[model samples]
Target: MASKNCCVMFMIFTVAIVQAVSYDTELFETAPCDSNACFDALHGALGDCSCNVDTIDYFNNVKIFPRIQSLVSKDYFRFYKVNLKKECPFWADDSRCAMKYCHIKTCSKDSVPGYVDEHENERPAEKYTKIDQTACSTDEDHNPDLGYLNMTISAASQYEIAKWNAHDSALENFCECDDRDADAEYVDLSLNPERYTGYKGPSAHRIWRSIYQENCFRPKLNPYESFPYVLSSDLSNMCLEKRVFYRAISGLHSSINIHLCSNYLLSEKGVDFAAPPEGEWGPNLEEFQRRFDPSQTHNEGPNWLKNLYFVYLLEMRALSKAGPYLETEEYFTGNPTEDEETRAAISNMLSVIYSFPDHFNESAMFNGGSQAAKLKNEFREHFWNISRIMDCVGCDKCKLWGKLQTQGLGTALKILFSSQWDSLEADPEQGTLPVRHKANKRLQRTEIVALFNAFARLSNSIRQLENFRIMLSANKEPEVKRNVFEGGGANIRSTKEQCSSGGDKPRIWS
Candidate 1:
C-alpha cells in the first residue's frame, strides 16, 4: 500500500509539472509582441524558413496558379476551400513565402532577445507552425501598409453598409411606384404610406420594373454580382487571390452590422473612439476586426462571427434595458417593417399557390412542363422541409401542436399520394371527400401560420438565451436568478457556472 501510494504521488507530480510547463509555454507564445524587439528580430532573421513538413497543393497560390479568366468568370470557376490557419506572422517581411507550414517569431522580449541581450545568445525565437501565407507574394516586395489592413477592412465595411441601406431604400420606393404623385419640391409624406393607390402608372411601373429586375433580381440570379466585395486597399495596390477574397468577405457583412451598432452607441454617447458604453459588452473594434478579419494572421473568422452575433444579441439586450428608462431608445431601434415584410412574403406566396392553375398553364406553355413540375416539386419539398425541421429541432410540444393542426392535411396528403389523380378529377364532387380535402387544405394553412408563430417565439427565446450566456460570461456574480418560464423563477447559477467554464453545450430548441 505504501509503495502504491508513493507511485500515485509521483505520477500526480509529473502530470502537474507537465501541465504547468505547457501553460507557461502557451502564455509565453501568446504574449504581446514588443515593437522594437520584433523589428530587430525580424530584420536580423537570416533566410526564409523552409517547410520541412509535407505541403499539399494550395489552390490560392496566385503566382503558381495565375488567373486566366475575367473577374466575372472567376466567380463561377473559382474552386478552393477556405484556409482557416493563421496568416503568416511575418506578413510585412520580404523573406516570407506562401506555405502551409512555417515558423514565426513570437516577438516576446524574454523569448526573443532585446538589443541589450542580443549578443548573449541566451534567448531563442519560438517557432510558430500552421501559418498560412497563401495571400503573400513570392516577390521581395512587401506592402508597407499591410499592418493597417484591418483598419481598411473596417472602413470598407462601413462604406458597404451605407451603400446597401441606400440601395434597399431606393428599391422600396421603386416597388411602391404610382402615378398620383406631385413634384418632389415640397411634398409632405404621410407617416403611414397608403397600401393601395387609386391611380396607375404603366410607364413608371415599367421603368421601375426594369430597374428592379436589373439590379435586385439579376444580382440574386447571377454569381459575380452576389459575390461579396473583397477587402484590398487602393493604397496597398495589392491583388488578392480568389480564395482570400472569398474567405475575407464571408463574415464581412455580419461584421459590418457590428460596426454600425458600435458606431451608433458611440454617436449616442456623443463620443468618438471610446469603449462601448455598456462596458466591455463584447469584443472592441480592434479585437473584433482582428478576430474576424480573414486577412489577419490569427483570424478565427467563423468563431468571431458567432461571437459578434452574440454581441449583437447583447446590444439588443441593452436596447431593451434602455427602453423602460425612456419612451424609446433611438439609437438601436428594431426595424418596424420586419413583421410587415414577413406577412407580405407569406401573402405573396399564398397568392401564387391559389393562382397556380393559370400561372402553371402559362409557364408550361412557355417554358415546358419541366419548369412547372420543378416549381411543384419545390412547393412539395418546402412542406417536407418544414416537417423535417420540426423533427430535427426535437421539440415535442411544437410537433404535437403541428400534428393537431395538420391531422386533416396529413390525411389529404396521404390520399393525394396514394389515389389516382385521374379518378379523383373524374369524381369532382365525390360525397364528403372533396369537403374533407378542402378542410384538410385549410388546416394545413393554419399549421403553416402556427409554425411561423412558433419560429418567431423560438427565435426570440434563443436570442434571449444567447444574451443570458453573454451576461453570465461578463458578470462575476455567483448567483443570478432568471425567469425562464412564465410565473416561475429558476436559479441559474449552475448554468452560469457552465457558461463561465465553457462547458455548456449548445442549446436545442424546446
Candidate 2:
C-alpha cells in the first residue's frame, strides 16, 4: 500500500511540475491535427468533440478522406458523430461502459529538442510499452495569428447564413416586385444593403435562426446543407461527423468570444473608442465612422468591409434574438395574422424585448447586454413565432391573450437582442466548434491537448480584444470579460466613472 501511494504521489507531482512550467507550444506536439495542430489543441481545450469511428477510415475512402479532411480541416471539428461513447468521460471507470481500444496508433516520435520530451515510458501506440514519451515540440512555423483565423470560420458560417438569408431575402424582395412597388428593390443579391429599411429587408429573426442552425450543425453536418453550405450526404453518415465537429466548433466559438471581448477592453485603442449614440450602435453609419476618425489608431481589425460584415452579423443575430419563437412552420412564414389574441401576443413580446438597450454600461452587465440579451430575445421570438403558427393550426389563444402573447414575445426578443453582452457569455462554450465532453474512447490525450491548446489561443485572442477595448475607449482598468468590444458599438449609457470631457465614453444625448 505504501509503494502504491508513493507511485500515485509521484504522478501527481509530475503533473504539478508540468503545470508550473510555461506550457510551450512544443509540449503538445503529439496533438493529432498536425498541419493545423493548433486547431487540434482547440478540441481538447474546449472540452471534447472527437472521433467516434473505431477507425477514421471506417467510412472514408481516399477521395472521401481528403474531402472529409478539407471539410474537417477548413471547417474544423464542428461536426456530428455516431461513434460517441455512451458515457461523457472516457476514463469514467463505469464497468458497463469501460473504454475499449479502437486502433489509432502513432508510429514514430520526433527527435527535435522539445519535439518529444525526454521519455519516461512509452506505449505500443508508439513502440515502447512504457507510459511517458517525450513532450511534443512546438512547430517551428507556429503562427499565433492563427487564432484570429476565427473570422474565416465566421465567414464560413456567414456564407451559410447568407445563402439562406439571401434565399429568404430573394423571396421577400421578389414578392415586392409587385406593381405597387416596381421601383422598389428586386431580388438582386448585388444590391444587398447593409442596413434594414424597417419597411422591407430580410427578417432578422430568420437570419439569426439561420445562423444558429448552422452553428448548431457547424460541428455536425446537417443532412441539409452538406458542404460549403449544404449537406448532400445521408443523415446517418453525416450525423456522426456532424455531431463530432459541432461539439468542437461551438466550444471554440465560446472561447473565442470570451477571449476577444476581454482583450478588446484592455487594448490600447480599444477603450479609446466608444459606443457613439442613438442610431449608431455598431451599425454601418457615416456618423459612427466620423466619431472615431480623429482619435483612430491601428492595431485593430481595419478593413471597412470586415467591419461591415461583422456589424451585419451582430445586427442580424440581435434581431433574431428579438423575434418570438414560433412554430416550425411559422419559422418560415409569418405567424397567424388572423386572431387578435395571437397578434397581441406578438406585439407584446416584441415590445418587451426591445427594451434591453437602456440597461447596460461598462459594468459587469456589459456582456449580458451585448450577447445574452439577444439570445434570450431570439428564444422569446421563436416562442411567439411558433405560438402564432400553432394558433392557426387550431391552438389559438384567447384573442386578447394571444395578441398580448405575441406582442410580449416579440418585445422580449427585441429587448433581448437590442443590447446583448451578458447573456451570450453564459454559454459561449456551447456554440464553440469543439464541445466539451464526449463518449469516444479512441480519441485520446494527445488530441485533447491539441484542442485545448487551440482553445487557449482563442482565449488569448479574446484577451487581446478586451485589452483593445480598454485602451481605445478609456474604460479605466480592464476586466477579462468574454466577448471583446474590439468589435464596435455605440454606448447608450454613461459609466458611473467620469471620463475626461469628450473621451471615448458616449456622451448621453438629452
Candidate 2 RMSD to the real structure: 32.5
User: Candidate 2 on 179-234: residue-level lDDT in tens?
Assistant: 12212111111111111112111221221222234223332333322111222122
Best-fitting candidate, scored by lDDT: 2
In candidate 2, how many Å is residue 336 off?
70
Point to the candidate with the largest TM-score.
1
Q: What is the lDDT for 471 in model 2?
A: 45
In candidate 1, what are the lDDT values of residues 1-510, reduced to their tens digit? 999999999999997776444322211223222122211111211111111101101211221112211210111111111111222221121222122111111222222111122114311111111232134454557764663333223445556665675454332120111111221011111111111111112221221122122211111121222111222222023211112112212222233323221221112232335643422222123322222234332222333233222322222222122122112111111234543443344443233223211110111111336764453333233223223222221122212222221222222222232222112222222111222233212212222222222222222322322333343345332121212221101110110000000001111122
